[model samples]
Target: MLTKKKVIISIAVLVVLMTGVMLLGNQEGAAEAENKQVTIEAVNNKVYVMVQQVNFIEKAAEIEFKASLEASEEGIVSSKVGGKVVQILFEEGEYIHQGEPLVKLEEKEAGNNLRAAESQLSAAQASLTSAEVNLESEQGNFERLKVLFDHNGIAKVELEKAEIAVKVAKANVEALKANVLTAQVNVESLTDSLAYTTISAPISGMMDEKSVSLGQNVDSGTILGKVKNISPINAVIEVKQTNLEDIKVGQKAKVTIGEREPLVYEGTLKSINGSADPSSRVFKGKIQLDNPDQALKPGSFAKAEIVNDQKVEIATVPLAALAGNEDSCYVYVNDQGIARKRSVIIGETEENVVVIKSGVQKGESVICTNVTTLQDGDVIEVVAE
Candidate 1:
């Protein structure tokens, strides 16, 4: 009975161990199947992309920069002479012409001085005339005395007195004539002072600012107002130092401002800075554009692009195909039905296309779409053109 009991217990232990081994094997198989499904899912995640066969374009190199439009002729119309403001002509913010009167100072005193100068001149002229008549009479008297003395009928003292009178009269005439000249100079000076009372615009523009009121006393160099010339306004561009080499004064450029069909304006490169800005490493440039209708305001933003004379035949690709920035730039090219990310040196852009300076060649297909989903060796299918 003991032996039979031992044989039943041993069979039950062996059966329990066999059941545990089979359960562990089934669990491992299920884990392996789950891992394999994940691998299959990864393999099925293919990105759909679009590509284009690019070619080289022969064109001149260009550089683009952004800046604002500044007034070409902006200055404060200051008081040239000090006086009380009498009349303020034209409204502030009104359009004024060159040399048009804007302000009138108190000129009553200047006018009175001018009249006084004129009276002094007239008195001098009368005195000069009387001196001349007296000189003529003295000469006649001296000649008569000389003739009488030659006949021994008059004393030599009378002739000497007549000669002295003639000398005194001539001296008086010269003095009066000098006084007339002095009076005339005073008249001219007073006339200029009176004219200075009427201050006019030195240039044609809108009155941008005013700093005076009627009946207010102002000193010389006081800013009465300002004129801003919008016609042929300045387009100021701050170009990067790297792009400053190709720009020159008098080169024609196109400027566009506003949005949704921006208005185009033709301009000439008016000036370029001699040195670069230390902080931004950019060179300032200026272009002058026409604004005949005065539609463009000062301080409006603008964009300027200048094309160099040198021509280059370089492979071009879409701007969207360039994945990185200027310093760390790259593009994706299709290599045997696979997307290969390539580091490229790029140049200027012409609208939607960009010139590939290096790392790309003519007749290569550039992957433009699905760029974000691509890897170095991502399988790609190019869309039909």
Candidate 2:
């Protein structure tokens, strides 16, 4: 009953209607799939969490300075008088005490001179004794002549002669006594010179070196050896000029010795240099260490860590939680079950622990382990074990 052209057009219209239905059905299916989608967990917050906040925390600070371990007291020993080295009592590296003889010079001439002076002193004493006896006898004679003259038994001229003899004998005795004193002084001088032949230590320490051998001539004030007292050693460290404010006298410092493990020493800051090195811009600070066991030696390399102050109970977080520029730190904190971005003020980072001045609350969960995939204000479900 229908024409052929009308039948063909009707077939084309039916085909287009079926295609539209198929396309609509496919789009509806895609919408259903999207509504049923689940969130992909991109952050594992439990893996990198801090176990506990350490109180009384010390900031990580280092002073990489040119340092030296030296005896608190050190000196070079020298001879006070010039002499030939006849004998050395101690060898190099020997321990010596104050006033301990270290060397002996040949004192043949000194000994002879001392003996001659003693002999002169003895002779002068004998002369003094003889003059004293003559003077006593002359005085007695003068007294007798005076008494006789009063009775007119002796002439006045005889009394005058007796008096003159007494005066002369008294003068001779006084002169001889003075000569004895001079001789005694000379003997003492010679004795002291002989003693100078034996050079002794001026301090108690280890003698590290010897400059002269037996029979070697030396001059006064010449370096004979070195005496270093290693007890209570000294350490010198260079601190940055910026840290000069923190460094002060009487602050405690810890030092490690000689690259060895478990060998540590505690020291007190002794002095700080007023001026810094112009080229390096670093100042020098000295510490006094107690080395009672004498384990630390002079010139030994040491590392010093000085603690200027202690950290307080401020907001702190793991170093991994920090984001953005190093100076401008941020963290992802949970706000009402949603991930929120917070800008925090920070200070004094050490050993993965960063101090927060503001913008983070205590006991609030912060994105610790994986924070890169989080967006601000995105709903999140806290995963708990």
Candidate 3:
């Protein structure tokens, strides 16, 4: 049989053990409750963000655009008149001015024609002189007959015949004069045709194409070559129709070519095509860029932007700060060391920054990045950089 004192001692030790177990369970429960608390950010939290001032106005705003560079004036040159090309004055890729002669036509035939016309004119002049001499002789005869008739030494009928002869000779001289005038006019026409044998440039530019070679026979109005003008380059850009509302005249643009240093240019929205591209639903706009060096050429791809009408100068935050879609933008702003989820009104949105219209004020810290992993009213320890 066990002693009664030993049984009582065992019961006391069991009660002490149970009390210690209860104490440990209570402490563990308290620690778990503290661990459930979320860690978040406050205004004092340090994070690097790119920031820009914005303009909050009653009307519109300015939106930045990215695009490439292009030239406006580009074309091919062609010939106006044609003949056997005797000489090409300019080499391929030579700069030429307006009215500069490009090719010389073989003027052998034209020269022969001119010479023939000149010979005909000379012959006409000789004929005119002969006709004048004949008229003078006939007039002298008529005058002598008149004298004879006055003295009654000649018959009236004979004097009348002499006078008729004089009149006929004078008419012949006048007809010969007309023929000389006609011959002179023919000479001038031939001379002009001879001048047209040489082909010239219509505009000042660099010769791009030279299709005719020496001794090549070409007809009138045949295309001989091309000249390209590369100055005051124009950039053609297509913008989304929805984005057109933000674009207007006299906007500044920055253009970049592939691997080329970016160029800062100013442009006046020269034209806006009313019709949208049928497949792309994009509208077309043109920007004129000054390219005095003739570096920009045609058929180059480019992009452009029209600075928004309104100047912007308001509080702005990083794009990561904004919550929800574009329609309902919100952010978690830090106020007095507490993270508060707030609804925000947005204005213009740039690449990485957004214009805050309302719901957030200047100098307020907002949770900019990693918003999806955050909760409302989270307690966060501010980490310093």
Runs of candidate 2 with Cα error greater than 4 angstroms are 1-65, 237-248, 260-262, 270-286, 309-385
Worst 10 residues of 3 by lDDT: 47-56
Candidate 2 per-residue lDDT over residues 208-250, each given as its tens digit: 8678887889887888888888777789898886778777789
Q: What is the TM-score of each candidate against the true structure?
A: 0.67, 0.60, 0.57
Q: lDDT of all the models against the reference?
A: 0.85, 0.78, 0.71
- How far residue 38's Cα lies from its native spot in candidate 1, in Å, is 10
What is candidate 1's CA lDDT for residue 167?
96
Which of candidates 1 and 3 is the stronger one according to lDDT? 1
Question: How many steric clashes does model 3 contain?
Answer: 11
Candidate 1, clashing residue pairs?
none
Tens-digit per-residue lDDT, 94-127, candidate 3: 7688888888887888889899999999999999
Tens digit of lDDT per residue, candidate 1, span 57-171?
7777666788698888886798877899989997877889999999999998888989989999999999999999999999999999899999998988888998999999999
Q: In candidate 1, where is summed lDDT lowest over 10 consecutive residues?
A: 256-265
